[model samples]
Target chain A: MVQKYTSMAYASADDLVFGKAKFPVKAGLGLEIGAGYTTPEINYAPRPQAGKSKEKLIKEYERITTDSMQRMVQIGAPSVVLETEHVEQMTNNPSWGGEVAHAQKTIMEEYHDEYGIKCALRHTPGDIREDRDFLKLRGDKYDLLMESFEQIAQNGADLLSIESMGGKEVFDYSILRNDTAGILFGIGVLGSMDMEMIWSDIADIAKKNNVVAAGDTDCAQANTAMFIAGGLLDKNLAHTIAIVARAISAGRSLCAYEAGATGPGKDCGYENTIIKSISGVPIAQEGKSSTCAHSDVMGNLVMQACDLWSNESVEYHGEFGGTSVQCWGESLAYDCSLMNVALKTGKEKGLRDLFTLSDKYRDPQGYVLAYENAYRVGQAIVKDGTDNYLRTKNAAVECCTILDEGIASGKLRLTRFETKALAKVQADLAALPDNSDQFMSDCLTKYKEEVAVFRPENYGL
Target chain B: MLDLKKEDIDGILIRYNVSLEKEMTPDEAAEELYPKDELIYPIAKAIYEGEEDDVIDGLKAAIDAGKNPIALINDALMVGMGVVSQLYDEGIIFLPNVMMSADAMLDGIEYCKDQTDEVPEPKGTVVCHVAEGDVHDIGKNIVAALLRANGFDVVDLGRDCPVDEVIEAVEKEKPILVTGTALMTTTMYAFKEVNDKLLEKGIKVPFACGGGAVNQDFVSQYELGVYGEEAADAPKIAEFILASGDGIEKLREEFHKH
Candidate 1:
């Protein structure tokens, strides 16, 4: 059975320092994440043409893996995480994913034995159930997803992670309308149920294989909001709504840790900051450095308390300076080096402040993600921790309150439209009944009719 | 225009993080926020502020003043949205501001349509959808809205629409163009499946695919695929399709950066 976090591992926000965690998990080669120093987690994908043949795919993986580790060795990276996000082709063909994982792990082992460079392979299989009706979460594709996870763990992967897509159907609908209650029902309740179901099995797989079930990310929910809010492409979704959705996602992602995932959660989960504060586990964060994969407003600020600094993901190709992995590896390694230097000089807090203040006021998303605000959201989550619905609702309320205060105090800048949105979101959240059962039932009756794809039965309502 | 004192205007500038020139006046700052024409200012400001009721009031006043409703849409409503888009591009404004402004502009357009007895012909028809199995549709939604704003009739196929549904929509709607967005690598392959099915059926509607996981290379590999680098590019692509007579290579040549 999973034990839900009811209290914070750190006494206060001040105690939540970078490169240190109250709960650290040791993985391959006796390397410890979230124990003493931050490490670079490098993620890359094979070129598109590799999908044409299994041989080409494996060969591409081998090239990128060896190339990245060699650069890590040259950079003298203390420890590195290589996240292999299995493409859809691999999930459909489970054996292909296993072979790729085995090959990459073998490369990691060879590098470690040769140069004393510690590394871990985080095998992230695609959530194949999303290919169809993810609501059912049981079918040939679902079976393949689970089997792929087990296969990778047994094939020398040190950590396991998946950007699971549970409750995304409803999240997509609710976020478009900026419906806070609907979002709560979708991510808070439906997403938690899916996380518990999947992570319970994944936790067992990790235990059986003696590997760490790292964590899950709210990529489908929160990251979608972040992407929409960051660029000028989509203007319908509010940054205020995105920030609140991120806080709500904390409850959903927390289910993974509750179900036995240890430390160093996935990199793309901007919600990992709050999860780190709540669960006190090592977290992998991607920020300004992640521009190779995507852009965001909080690149500098996200580094405030990360244990594993990542470049999100870069394609396996060459750049002007070097291959994508080599170039991004140096970028990530240098960032880690700065933090390590700060830790050595006992100036970690000073460096953390610079990171936090630089991007805090640039966007509401960044303001809420600042470590101080994340801790507040964390406190709100744990205050109602036992109840998934209530915890997420509390987190959203805290985020809104934080933004409201920031705007009122003239610390956070927002346009007139954004200010109006913040008010509307706060009012909408306030309108929801404080009772979780009432909120869930009301959302069920409402969203069932409003959202065509939403079914309460999928969430075990 | 915006009947605000200097303090209120300064407060607006501060809230939006807009720096004024050393000696710029509050009037100039207001003009910077929206157009400064007597007839267009109120409507533009209403749209910029996303005030739907005010937009309606401004449109009613413009109509009473014997202004052409369609001209108001082109000059005032679209112009106001243009300002909002520019502010967003400059990072002075954000998504919520754009959404509200879009809502206000659309409302103004609807009001203008109500005032006119003759139906305004749309430039063309387009069908937009998020790729199958991918529920991230904000990009699709924005593209659809922009297309509608540019006077195109958009048949919106909402998020996670299956491949069959897309093909069915195309066959039924007979749209001039179709677009697909996918934010995940796993789901992006569904775009290829969609294009292939369209090819098998001999439906040669120009297909524009984009999103985080999609690139020009992936789209170029398939026939009838035009990569959209931004949501703003959708309407331009639709215009290009209408003008160029559905040539995929030309459409790609004009739009795809890489």
Candidate 2:
């Protein structure tokens, strides 16, 4: 039997009913979806609206979640991974760690385990920067955050795709001041500096507790918030994607696309555009596309040749507009680091040059065409490929060359986004406590079978 | 990448280049950010629609062309800022763009001021601080910048400031208005601490307080406190306080019921 792949797809309530979405191809891999009350923004109701009662919120989760999981089974998903949280921590309702295990054991394993279908749970500690209560309290927040991280791991999640918030400054201040609740960072605030400090620190904490650290791109989240709700941020997709792909390439773990509900059109909706800064300045493509489009699907291939950026292995939901096999949508994060661009800015010449591939694949519909093509290749690779170590190394060398060419001429200037990314790969080599250096090796080891087939290489450095 | 001819390259640097993959035109973008009157079209066109050089070059050209410095400030610079404020208010632009615009606007303001003999005193003196123990001052900074943009003398005390420091600054500055921001529920209590101290000293200071954590209920609990729901309202509130003779209580009557 082959090991399961991490490229996940989801089952949305709206799509399962209206779209007649099929099950993601259960090549016996992970089936994950972004949804429900998993993100801070989605669960946290706007102020003055008086959040729903604990009972009502729980009932809503129950309704959406059970239907979603059942859709996985109906679609013949080989295995399922559920993303959830106990209660909306930002709200008045108080629930804690056990709900994670309960969901895993009851909502997930109970039904699928019978058919030898593996099931798991994913968790995003949903904390928004705008949440008033979240901004306060030093240690309780950390303990709560850690509690969720440890709980999911303990409850036997096949993969604990963790979500995080807070900057190194706040983390350090919290540590130095003996303040427990760290400063609230809107998601995707982690930078190269933060990775050097806080990310490694958290990685250490995760390692100590044997938790899997899932890395995600900040651009998808930032763009989603920018397009949907205006705020101050950088919306460059190429720059952000390069940074995230590098981070994952260097061993940050699985590419977790959590949050974002919608994206720019795959074909005719929004014209092909580059990622713009928060103030609406157009820069080159920095990271992922704004919506579920070709750039995003292509981004997965770019990362997958290195790490798990998209779920190759799931139930389909019609709502997202992704094709039937398995659908990995996008991430929804609101990053708040807009103060540093004037001194130096992110420039994306080479990365933009690489995304010319997305343009080339833009036949009929750019994003949709790419998405469909990627899954087709994914299905074939999963089923027919031979697992050989030498062959894997050969494939890895080719991917490395592809990545090298992609980033060879690119640079993200402000806050040193590109330089910092390249530095992270070399710096990881210096062997900080986070084991930043051994990430590529670890990727090779973790997916040796995949390495034989995918021939993954670290494009980060 | 751009493959632009001389015209296209110069095109972007001049007015708001309308072809940068955005749906709206530069003029429409400016109108949406700040929808006041026709006077601001030039400066707003430069700062919002045009690039950084576009903004600076536009201002320099105006000054060289014999436009009065103060008229430029009132009609163009300040008006452009009004749109910047509105853009931020309406969620049309985020902080990064606002900061970039603010920088461009200040650059113009400074150059124009150099051309004049006496720089006009700002609208009023308003002291601002983040409540003690709250390091999240992104909101407070936005308010202080807008206040400065509106020609207010802002004595900005950075975030996590002690309550005593707030009172000390109030005593020293004796500004027409004061503002405090708190992004944490636990730390917002410091707003009351500073207010009560000011009240004890019989300082009829106007303190407007608001942030992620401080609600209208929390802000209204103090004697001199007025709830600041939005940072964009800083200029108007300071103007109101100066006009109302620093009447803190009147803030509740005028600004509330939003």
Candidate 3:
């Protein structure tokens, strides 16, 4: 039987019902979605080939765009948000005024008519370096943004998620505060923020305008508090929670994404995860995506992500040969790490209930690990290798060692990363009589032995 | 065949840089342990690998057979550490193997201490640790293991060491070199405190810093700092101090410019 969305999906008040736990009770899982739009890095593939004809170019664009959109949808995602671009030179240099209008009209018609889904036209408010660039607030350049939003809204655009600022600035700028009000039907904040305030404001603004309100932050548990605080609509909260929860739990947020940029994806995709996850409310983790080169690599990644879901409804992001896994994994780790936070915050049950709902509707394999048609297997492995291996193996090894010793020593059984930490302390105490080197050797041996128990029977012939 | 006991292999790794294929016989293992020409190594790995049928008899027999203990220690054990160090840098060896090799090397060192008439002074005292908030200490542990294998006195602070404790140890011990390994951006900042405080008090202990989150740019940017590119680089850094007559400034001048 098809399952209905959890009551948490519809419940919102001072007494928030987050998964299994009721509010006015204790802390529950916190989740935020909103990563600002980022200009595609200059180096990604499918970028403009140096020498290509209009026909070839159009074909490539269509192939990439269609595949990406379909991948987004298959992931149970409601929409694919693209970096805003103009019909710079569409087939035959048609009139700028006429072409953009025509493009918007065609896009709206195709989204609802052909795909039975919605599309969002996003662009920089200004030159990406400039603040308020996308809102059409800065000089004449803002005209492009204003016109695009107007044309899309008037035509068939379902919702608009504007990149308010970089993750840090989103809280400070309060982009949803005033200036852009009434100019658009709905608004979403992309990037990091003070979650508690952001959620209250989103709720207030969304209610005032009679439109949906949403915002998202990076993988930090503090950031997720916004969602728990009634920061976004049900649809937005659900989607954000699932994506953030799964990413953090799997330890995907530790790897670096953008080259030369710090804090992993100080460049792009990181912020996009936040924004889209928040804006696509009630969708839960459906907004997350992972870009890799093949299916198997991303498949393993999706499985790992599924393991991270506190709410049985898993949230993951998959793309084939699209972006860097280093960036993707870092964000994923960040999401996975937040799961414990969700549990402690009293939302583990609600999140788990949502997972149950999600699992029934989708098979584990059906979960989206690729975007479009191309599948990336090996591409993501190395990307996930460095940071992912460091964190995951550390946890896994620690866990096994702790469990094995606890059993041998006749201690009560425990499961969870915390058990590993606790078991380590106990093991250390037990091994204190040995010299440091011997102790370390014993610890490592015990750890390996314990970990071997969890390993598959056929591992490493 | 590449099959071999992990710990026995661990010994050969300490005494010689060579590794055995799985499942080799005692004779074959001995042959693999011996040299072909010019006798660069003075002892065979067989003696070290041999199991004791009678502990007292085995020791007496080996001595009567004129197997030099120091020669065995230098050839089989130190050589193994050198090989392990190289393998570690090449990523062919991991922390556990390096550790096992270090342990074997230490066993040889302890044996030498017991057998010799006069004990040798340790190469130098070096302080090492992973900075606070940095839980990944495998790198630091590897550095300490290698340093110990090479005869330096290593005071390992283990993982998540605070800056004040590190500074107090430096002030009291005045170790020729104090190293901090941090694999997280958040934790790497503490190294700067250690570096700054040392320079502030006019102390000149060369601070060797390196790990995943740390880049050469960040290390060189700090005062009295030398960037250790790999765990193996620790011994090389220690060598500079021993050669420089405990002059940390001279060591830093030669190495920190990079």
Candidate 4:
């Protein structure tokens, strides 16, 4: 019972970075934004106008979402995510939350009607119970979500994302019962106990169905994501590691993005640099406060590294255990490449996390080449014959070491030119120092300046 | 360090173990199950881990030991809870652990009081709740637990609580601080309603509001509206108002901006 994965991903993954060419929208890629009119913070607005029927409030929410989706389509976004709250969850309506589901479906219809793009309706039930409590759904009121989902699919939902935050019970049920064109797990914040198990389960399902695993990479801010971010837990590193591990083993692509700074700016890494707290991770600390942006910068780099290594690790097709490709740690070379791009070339592309920030794999081989070229010179210092770093504990050194186990079989799919380029970068990074902060900071400063333009006014929903 | 096993310790929750971060390690799990203090460890262990039965049984035993009521209060129980506060801050512990720990701490204190005929006055009373339109209270629940652990008597007005109910609790309780949490945008306005009603009644209670959807800009718009950024800020806010006596304006100046 070996795991199968996608091995026939394009020869040049860089070309697929911004997502596959949009016949109308990016195929197999989409961003899930909590739609509805919200205040400066992304909470449900119109709370002031109370006693409005569920229908009326939903209509207002749909109107606001329709506007946002049109803007998204204009920007060449491949997929749109529209989520609906339970009638009981939203207002005190007992009419099965059907209208609420249909309201989301209508937004999808309107988006398709206008831009003809596919939309994923994330049916959000209030009871986001985990495996422990989710099983209590036998006769629970949330069964209405299943009913509403049927109608939405019939009306033309391109994708039915079981919005089970960290809950898999509902996800399993949705995929089994629904006849939607596509099934995905709306894992905004994976607060589950066994994340690797969840990814494995998702991979198992993708073996048979067209499935995607999406998550919010904002790291900290709200209910679940906040604990990871504000606590300064080292779980961020675990997340990237798990994604690549799963990418090689699971037959699904991992999609991760941010929820934006819609809450306290300092808490969510909005405008502030880093705010120190007792909960901060020790390794990610600067003086006292956790360097929030630095952790994120590292997070972005690790994920892109995952894509590169996973892209070449296992020769998985949609078929299960097609070819047992050992991951020869080719991704390590890519990571070294990125470090060179950041430190030597002084480029911002070197720092982007492909899962959350970009759709493209920015010049990974180029960065590796730059790193290798520098290591040959005294551009990077090496301490102890073993401790090679661009700087002390350079972020890339830890990141690449994280993927040292995966050994892909067969000669890597790199072209002769690509192969020479990668070899050159690997050579340059051979004796680098672990001083990542210097290289990481330069890239982060540039990244922050670039990302400031895309901050959403609101965040939590 | 005690030789007691997990099952012997009683009250540690193995399930409900997932947080945004990693799972609790076996060391943390062991520390939680077995109280460090060997003497009244049962009480602390019961409270810290998850056992009401152990708490009750241990309290009776301490009373039977004829332990000095006051000495027991200051040394054994407080020391255990001090560890709890630190573990909580480190995100190494859970609320149920703290809640049961506080209960054990209180039961020991109460047993000592009954024996010595001593009745200690509570440090202060605090009223907490989620806003009228929001039903999410896990954050509020955490705040109340921390406040209780820190020695304040918290009157929790449950989530989806109406403005009148919160104001009623505040008026009746005459608390030092009244806090409301909301994770929805629509319900944030309810914080303003509570503020206006409190103002109308000439009750000048400090109203703290925060949660997922609450913004400093939004909460600051209402009177007596001081924004609490996280649940961890709850006990700190209580200590601030009680210690400084600087009122709401001073709090706003320190913790929030327009």
> In model 3, what lDDT does residue A229 have?
17
TM-score (0 to 1) for chain B of model 2: 0.76
The DockQ of each candidate is 0.14, 0.06, 0.02, 0.07
Please provide, for model 1 over A1-461, each residue's C-alpha lDDT reduced to its tens digit, 9 standing for 90 to 100: 87888998788888777898889889876689988799999988777567767899899999999999999988788788898888777876888888999999999999999998878888888877744333556566667888998888888889988988788778876675566777878788889988998898898899999999999999988888787666423444667788889999999999999998996899999998899899989999999888989988788989999999999888789899789999998899999999999999999988898788767776788889888889999999999899988899899999998998887776565765566678888888888888877887787788888677676655566
Better of 2 and 3 by TM-score: 2
The reply for model 3, stretches above 4 Å from the true place, is A1-461, B1-76, B86-96, B115-117, B243-258
Fill in the DockQ of model 3. Answer: 0.02
Candidate 4 chain B worst ten-residue window by lDDT: B9-18
Residue-level lDDT of model 1, residues B1-258, one tens digit each, is 012233343443242332321244323443677776788889988887778999999988988998989888888988888777666565455555566677678889889988877666566889999886566666887788777656688899887889999999999999899999987665777788888999999999999999887888888888889999888788789878777889888898899897
In terms of lDDT, the poorest run of 10 residues in model 3 chain A is: A22-31
User: Each candidate's chain A: what TM-score?
Assistant: 0.97, 0.39, 0.30, 0.35
Report the lDDT tens digits of candidate 4 across residue range B128-238: 887765555557866787787787889987777888998889889899998899766666777888899999999988888877657787777887888988676778888
lDDT of 4 at A21: 17
Ranking, DockQ, top scorer first: 1, 4, 2, 3
RMSD of 2: 16.9
Worst 10 residues of 2 chain B by lDDT: B12-21
Q: Model 3 Cα displacement at A237 (Å)?
A: 42
Winner of 2 and 4 under TM-score: 4
Candidate 2's displacement at residue B45, Å, is: 3.5
Q: Per-residue lDDT tens digits of candidate 3, residues B1-258?
A: 012233343332221111221244323443544544223232223222322222223333444667555554554555545555554454332343445446555655566557656555455789998886454554676688779867688998776787888888888877888999975444577788888888888887888998754767677777677888667678888987777665645655666545
Q: Is model 3 an incorrect, acceptable, medium or high docking prediction?
A: incorrect
